[model samples]
Target: MPSIIKCLSYTLPSNVYTNEDYYSNFPDVKSVNMEKIGVKQRHVITQGQTASDLAQLAAEKLFLEHSIDRNMIDFLIVSILEHDYYTPSTACVLHGKLGLQKKCGALDFDLGCSAYVYGLGLADGVMKSMGAKNVLLLTTSVLTKTFHPKDRNSHFVFGDAGTATLLTLSEKENLGPFVFGTDGSGFEKIIIRDGGTRNPLDKNSENELKDEFGNITSNANFAMDGIGVFNFSLKTVPTMIEELLTKASLTQNDIDLFVFHQPNKFLNETLRKKMNIPEPKFVHCLENTGNTVAGTIPIALYESIANGRLKPGMTVVLAGFGVGLSWAATIARF
Candidate 1:
C-alpha cells in the first residue's frame, strides 16, 4: 500500500483558445513565449459556469472510472481561492454533487497556485492522524470567470480547469518532507481588487478599474502587478524547490520531473535559467491551457503520467506559487 496518488483524474473545460486569438483582441497582451512553455494550446471554460461545477465533473470521472464509493471518503477538501460562494464552501457543494453528504467533512481553502501541493500535505496529515483510509483532494479554479477580457495580462494567460486526486493510506512510506511557506507581505502582487471582504462589490467601497483604452473594464475584475509577480515568483519558486530537495535529503539529480504552477513561459524559463535546473525535467502546460490557477499542477501531472513523461517509481518534484503571496513544494515517488 502506498499512501501516494492511488488514482488521479482531471477535467478541462471543453473549450480551446490560441495566442493569436488572445492577442488580436488586445494588442497589448504580453506575448506568451509559447516555445519555451511547451504549451501549444489550453482549455477555457465557458461563461456562466462556476468552479464547483468543474470540480464535480472531474470528481465524478474519478469515482466512475476508479469505482470508488463516495461514502468511504472521510474528508473532502476543495483547494481554491475562487468559490461559487463565500459562505457555503465549495467542498460542501462538491460533496453534495458527489453524494458524499453523510460521512464526509467538507471545507474550502483560499489558496491559488499553491493549492494542490498544500492540499496534498494537509490531506496526508489529517488522514494519518485520524486513521482514515481514503481522502479525496479536489481543486478547481476558473481564472477566466474572474478575468476581464480587457485585462491583457491575465486574460491572455489564465485558463479554466479542475482536477481531483485520491490519496490513500499505504503500508509503505508516505510522501515525505513537504516544503511549504507564505509571504503575505507581497499579497497585493496578485490581487483581485473587488468581490471580497476587503473590497466587496458594495456601495460602501469605491472600487474601480479601467482597461488599456482607458474605458472602465468592470467593477468586479482581477488585477495583478505583473512585474512584481514575475520578480517574486522567479525568486521564490526555485529556492523553495531546492529547499524541498534538501529536506528529502536529495539533490537536483534525484528528481525525474519537475511540475510547477503553469504561470507563463517566460517565468518558467527565467526560473530554470537562474537556478541551473535541467530543462528537460521542467514540465509545463501553459500554451494549451494557459494558467489554470491552482489546477495546473495536477493537470500537468496527469498529462505527464499519460504521455510517459512520468512512470512508476520515479521521483517528481511539485512546486506552486502565486496569488496569496504563497508558495509550496514537495517531492513524491510515483
Candidate 2:
C-alpha cells in the first residue's frame, strides 16, 4: 500500500432541513418514511452554491486545521457524483482555488457511494505509478438540487456535503487489498436520466411525471428506485465483504470497526443483521447528515474519529455501495 491518509476534513452548507422543517414545508411529508431513513436533519446548499464550493472550504479547513503544507501536495483527485461543469474537471478548478504548486497534477471522476474507496485506490495507484508523494482526495455530492420538486422518494434522503482527504506515499501500508464491483445492468436503479450526452437536457427533460405512489420527478432530475437499490445492496454487499475479508486475510472478528456508506438506517441495519456483524463494530453515522452519496463514508469515518470511536491502531474495513449499483470494500490499519 503506497497511500496513508494524513488528514480528513469535511464541510456542509448552512441550510439545515430538520424533520420539523420538512413537515412545515411539505404537508405530505408523512408519505415519506422519515423513521426508516434515520435522518433528523440534513444540511443543503443554498441557491447558487456548488459542490466545488463546499470542497474548496473543506480543503481550506484541512490545510488550516491540520497545518498541512500545500506546497508538498503533488497530485489532486476530486471525486463527485455531480460536477460544476461539462468540460473542466472540478479537480482543476480546485487546484486553482487552492493555489497549489503548478507542478501538481489534477483530475476528476464521477462515482456514487463507492467513490471514496475508488478515490483511495486511485490515490495509491498514482503514488505507485506516477510517483505522487502527496495526494489530495476530495469527495462531494450535491444531490438536493438534483431532486425533482415533487419527488418524495429521494428529496428527503439526500443531503449535500464535501470531504477532503490528504494521503501520502508510505513504506508501510495503511490502506489496501480492495475488492470492487459494478453492475451496469442495474444502472437505472439509481440515475440522473438527462444532462449527459446520452440524453441531453431538453424542454421535455423537466416534464414531471408522478409514480403510482405519487412521488414525482423528471428526466432532468436525479432519482433512485428505492426497492431496487435496497435489494441490490442486500444481494451484493455481503459477497463483496466476504471477498474483501478473504483478500485481506482477515476474519469478521479481526476488524475493529466496519465503516460502510450511510445509505439509510433501515437498509444499513438490515445489512448489518444479515451479515451477522456485531452492532458496536458497525458505524452508523447518518443520524444528522442524511445520505451524502460519495461524501457518506469519508464523512462518517471522519466523525467516528472525532468522537474517539475509530481510534489509532485499529483495524477497520471501509465499504461503499450504491449508484451504478457499484460496490467496493477494503481493509485498512488506522
Candidate 3:
C-alpha cells in the first residue's frame, strides 16, 4: 500500500497582528530585524480558539472543497506543540468535533517545524500495515500563546495556523524515502520552560525578566536561542537535503520545487542559496504567514498550488527543521 496526498487545506484566525504592533509595544527594541524575518503580519488566535479548533476548521475546508467523505477516514494523526488538554489527544478532540466515525483511530504527536514530514511518514506506514484507505494528517500551531509579548527573539517570527493534508491509498505513491535527524543536545535551543511536569508552573514562573537584548519574558513563556538555531540550520539543512537526495537516488535538478520549513525569510533564503537552488525552484510563502511551526510546510504547499508554482505530477522535495533539534526531508510527486 502507498499513500498519495489527495488534497491540502489550511485555516488561520481572522485576527491580524502586524509588525508595527510589535514595534509599538517594544519601543526600545529598535534593532529587531523585521524585514529580514520577512513577515509583515501574522494571524493570531483570538481569545477562545485552540489548536484543535483550527485543525477542525481546516479539515472542514478540505471536506467542502474536495468533497471528501469524513466517514471514510480511518486514521487521524495530529501534530501540535500545544494541546487543549494534557490527557486527551488533540486528534481525538478533532475527531469528535468533526463527528468522524467511531471506528476512526486518532493520535497526537509533539513536534515542531519538522512535524509535517514526520506525519507523512507515519501515515504511509500506518496505511500500509493497517490496510487502511484514508489517513488525515493535521498539523496545527498556536505558538504565539507560548511567546512572551516582549520576547523579541521569538514573538515576531511565529504565527498561529493549522493545516490538513488528506493522504489516501492509491495505485501510485506520491510520498516516500524520508531522511530524519535529531540532536537532543540542542533541546534547550527552543523550549517552553515552566508549563511541563519537570518545571510545573508556580507563582514565581510569572516573574518577568529582561535579557541582554532588552527583551522581557517570564519563565512561563517560550524562549529561544536564536544564534544556536541559526547555526544549527546552517550546519544541518544542506547535509539533510544531500542525504535525502542520495537516499531517493535523485539529483537536485530532478526536484521541481524545494519546500522547506519557513523559519524566517533570512534563514530560508540562506538555505536556498547554500543549496545552490534557483529562486524560481523554491517556494517562499512567509511574507504573510510567518512561521507557523508544524503548519509551515503544508501552508507553503497550499500556497504553491494556488499560485501555480506546484503542479500535478511534479517532483517536490519537502524538508523541515527546528524545535526538537530535529530535521527531516522527503521526496513527493504532486
Q: lDDT, candidate 1, residue 23?
A: 62
| 134-245 per-residue lDDT for model 3 (tens digits) | 9999998998987776687677888899899999888876797999999999999988889888999998998898877677788899888788899999999999999999
Predicted structure with the largest lDDT when compared to the true one: 3
> Lowest lDDT 10-mer window, candidate 1?
29-38
lDDT of 1 by residue, 1-334 (tens): 3468788888888877776676677665345443454555667778777788889988999999789888788889888766777577778877887888486678788789888999988888877776667889998888777666666556666788888999988777657678888898987777666676666686733345764545334557677777788889877887898788878889888888888888887788788778887888888666678788888899889889889898999988888898889898887778
Off by over 4 Å in 3: none
Ranking by lDDT: 3, 2, 1
TM values, all candidates? 0.90, 0.97, 0.97
Better of 1 and 2 by lDDT: 2
Instruction: Report per-prediction Cα RMSD to one decimal.
Output: 2.8, 1.3, 1.3
lDDT (C-alpha, whole model) for all candidates? 0.79, 0.88, 0.89
What lDDT is reached at residue 276 by model 2? 99
